[model samples]
Target: MSRRIRVPFVLLLLVVAAVAPVGGAAATGSSDAGTVDVAGTADLDGTADADVTPDTAAGIATNHGGTIVRTTTFSLTPGEPGSVDATMRFDLPDGVPELTVGPFPDGVTVVDEGGFDREGDRYVRRDHGRAALTLRFDLPSEQLSTADVGIDTGDWAYVRVPYVPTEWSYYGDAPAFRGDAAVDGEGAVQGEWAYLGATETTTRSAGDLTVRYVRAAGDPDAPSPDAVFAGWNWLATRLGSGGRDRVTVFALPTPDAMEWRRSPGLASDEDGAAYVFSRAPATGTEPAWFHEFVHLLQGPEPSEGMEWYPEASATYYARLAALNLGASEYGTFREASTVEEPRNVRFTRRSSWRSPTDYRQGALALGAIDATVGAASDGDRRLADAHRRLRDDDRLTYDSFRDAAVAAGNGSAGAEADRVVDAPARHEFVDDGLAYADHAPDRDLDGDGLDLATEREHGTNPFLADTDGDGLDDPAELDRGSDPLAATRDADGNDDGEGSADEPDPKTVDSDGDGLSDVRERELGTDRKRADTDHDGLADGEEVEGVTDPLDPDTDGDDLGDGEERESGTDPLAEDTDGDGLPDGHEVHVGTDPADPDTDGDGVPDGEQHREESESDGEDVPTWSPRGVGEMVGDLVEDALELPRMVADVVRLLT
Candidate 1:
């Protein structure tokens, strides 16, 4: 219950501080997908290639050895309050590539183009030498500065319009460059969040994911990039995402609060970019930036049924990430997950969504599924496991979600998932710590100092004390750097049984058959391998149960231990066995029966005699003297015999 930050956590904080943010550069690059997706709640076609390493600069073409498959140049001009002017140029050396453009959400006009004819929804550039394209963005439909694509302030332009890099046919055979595409980045910026102005950017990396923050030159009051990076690192690591090369987070700072809506931000998973206003969320509980940042990790193929998934996951993961970082409490998370919407409206109608019910309730279902699977597995898996499955599947459904849960946990877990999916908290319980203590096996049944959840998390058996048969319990194995799941070798790769020779028997919790387990023995500083640690007639188990000192043979500091006083019975925890005003230990020391009040039975109790002797050294207090009392009894017996003889003599004389 005493919570102190562990050494590893302290070291992680230090690491986060060590990788400080630096002033960097920002560039422009457009993500080429079949369809255009905005940051609010839309989706693009392609999922990011996690393996592809970007140039570390924001939107530079991905580096795959060296090859030239496609080249694009993007230039942006800061225009009106909510729009920007952009120009895109591409070098078409070999053949004419598909130049997809236009059909934007109104307010976008094709200002000019060198050699292109307008097709139905796209522009057809017939020439192959060089293509020049320009467009004016007046995103009147978007809220002040919320859109990720075309956001223009009075002085700076921050946008990631797919139209910017008009052609992305080369990004793959890799997303920005195709086969042997030795792409050249001249004065162009890189990454999804492009800042068009004479302003420097800042880049920070946590794990493998790097975030480039684009700001107008010398904009102070930005949150320390490291502060946010650490949270992302914790969440991403838990989700099994290592380093994800680099992503862009364009932090647009508003001097006047009225300039942009509070906490306005958006992210593109395809482009790995998030453009958010530098302001806290309305309520601190929901962090808008974290929510936007989490969007970079997820991309759902737009299907009709689970349309609410991306938003739900983002919302839940943002809260979860905060919870794990200690920024929020578990109650908040659980409450947020609890469904308040109508059961039929939310659960029955999959296609239709009602805000809190569909998104928040869906999150709750995910939370419940995670808890069930994690508890069933003893903590080896989480919702992220199922999430990865859902993310990979072409179509998302309750059945697929159920299958993923079952695969991650077990059949029962999947059933729990379905039960929760249908209605919140119906059949199974939910706990982030995986507290399935009431389950059949019972948590910590083996009593090896680890709970069932911890054992399952470590791949150890919940029922078995020694999972690896390594003569050490799982916890002891871990302490000695031995693998809890492997027994063939020790921590140092010593296979000759040398490491386990001195350890207690891991085969049983009570190695020495004492009532206390080995772990408990160690805690009490008792010898776990010895049943009688104190070497008294009483076993250590009995001593502990009786609340006597296990380290001392005489628990009450009495000279006579229970073994010596067993013939007549004695209290090991009590000083006076007979309660005759003398300690049992003193009676034994003074040559008297400790279990009895009288040793000689001369009408003087032995304890009283000892007390009297101690008071007068046997020279005074005759009433308390044992020898004097014995002589007096002998004389009384002699007088009785003489009286009987005299009575017989008197009767003879009368006759």
Candidate 2:
């Protein structure tokens, strides 16, 4: 299979050769006289022609050739996609001209070839051929390129991209993005910021957003003067609700400065007290301002028993939005998997796994929940739909959100949630093996009196029927082309009774759908559902994940996906192979020499013997590192001492 998309958007190759300056080579035809027509004539037809002028108001125009010019610029807008529109005008100088435009680039789509709308000053040229050769075209939004824009004269032409961004427009309003703040008049009003809860605390509204900044009323250093104004701009941007939602930021500079000094009674921080202000902004590290603004819109965490789903859902939304907008570096949310966990010393005492694992798994569970619900609703009740229902229709409690999701999926308010039943089992893998056992809920799958729940209690794996009493699960056998009920057979058709089937075991499924199997994912130090093991938010399974061939790294020969090695700071091929603090290539870059442990000036390497020499006088021996090695050595020494031949030699020497 080809690794890259067959219809690649861009292609560039280097050729070692000398060529004459453009237009110096030939002039087989003139603009006034007839010329052969080809697709791309904009960038490479002539020497600097006279200034052609644009008849219309939208694009720039040059006068000499009288050719109308247009350009395209890509933006960080979603849903509106991307597109290019241009109208070319060539004023034929009373000459019979057979003008040809040729050699269009790959993937350059022509949406409309003729005139579209005719407005007052700049309207469509219905019949440009009669006056001049005017060609109007619309480029595909998803794929934009100049490869198609080549120059073609009657007999000769040149190659270069000529389209420029003279006038750009989107189908719908563009949403706010990171750079939106940089736009003029988009910043805070009145050089000074309003302080929350301080004397300057006030309510203001702009565009569909309401802004409120509250500092502690009694505190002297309640709110900074600048934060309040920035907050207003943030609110306005979010409420605009077009391309990307903006937010009003709330900044608490110190631990004691927040309005709410105490942790309120709530389930998770995602669903914690939203109405109250915090001494510090909520979790998230980059661009410090946006994270807190999202929390402000979160309002207060839903009252106990009320719906708190929005808190977590909104946080998820902000995180995804930030990623899409390029506001935060990739992998910013890797460690936020378990949302509601508290920050106590004991909370960190779980088995030796990292925090990002939990966050990724937890987030994936939420995504799966959304998917399950969306599937049930035939696409009507989406994740956003569920959120709306929770706040508007239901009372907004844990039970309420759960019921809404279940109802949306089953198309009934009281329909039994068989899917929900599997969640507890699934949670065990994600939540560090801490969950209830599997319990198939009572659900009528077949019209017969028997239920799936009853079958689970008595039947074997549903996909695999393994009735013959073989140890392998039927699904496992079918995966390996062996009969599940029959004696286990290896690839050679031998009844080996060893190793499970060639297929992976199903128990260790990934929580995220990133494609890394759970067991291998864990062994390889990665999220099972996510191929990108580093929680950098990219998938290693996809060629895009910084691994060229997610399946076969050796195939690319680069030893890394151009993306993975360039971005995530991990070796694309090896995992901790060098035993350096950094991954292999990184160590190589820092000159620490990945293969050598003692790259430093120090004499000792990093293993047990070196460690022993470096420890303090009273330090205990590192038993965990040396136990097995020491015991095996002691046994060998004792055996050597007891050798009868050696003992006899010693006795003779003494006599």
The global C-alpha lDDT for each of the candidates, from Candidate 1 onward, is 0.53, 0.33
Q: For residues 1-655, what per-residue lDDT tens digits would candidate 1 score against the true structure? A: 0000101100000112121122111121223333333421112233333332223346443322222133223344434566566555555533223344445545666778667777765676644456656666664323344433455554555554443224322221222333110112212144433556555566776545666766556666456666567667755555433224677666666546344554466666655666666655423445666777767766344344455566767777777667555465445655655554334433433423445554566666666666657655656676777766666665567677678778888875666654555433322114323331223334565568887556644546554567656566778777755455545443455542355444334333665677886557756755555687655677777878876777666677677765555544778778887777778866665556667676665667666665556433333223334655676886587567657655875674333
Whole-structure CA lDDT of model 1:
0.53
**Per-prediction backbone clash count:** 23, 60
Candidate 2: worst-modelled 10 consecutive residues by lDDT: 1-10
Scored against the true structure, residue 145 in model 2 reaches a CA lDDT of 23
TM-score of each: 0.49, 0.25
What residue runs in model 2 are displaced by over 4 Å at the alpha carbon? Answer: 1-208, 214-311, 338-364, 371-381, 397-423, 426-655
250-330 in candidate 2: lDDT tens per residue? 232232322233321111111111122333332232222333343433322343323223333434444443432333323
Evaluate model 1: give its TM-score.
Answer: 0.49
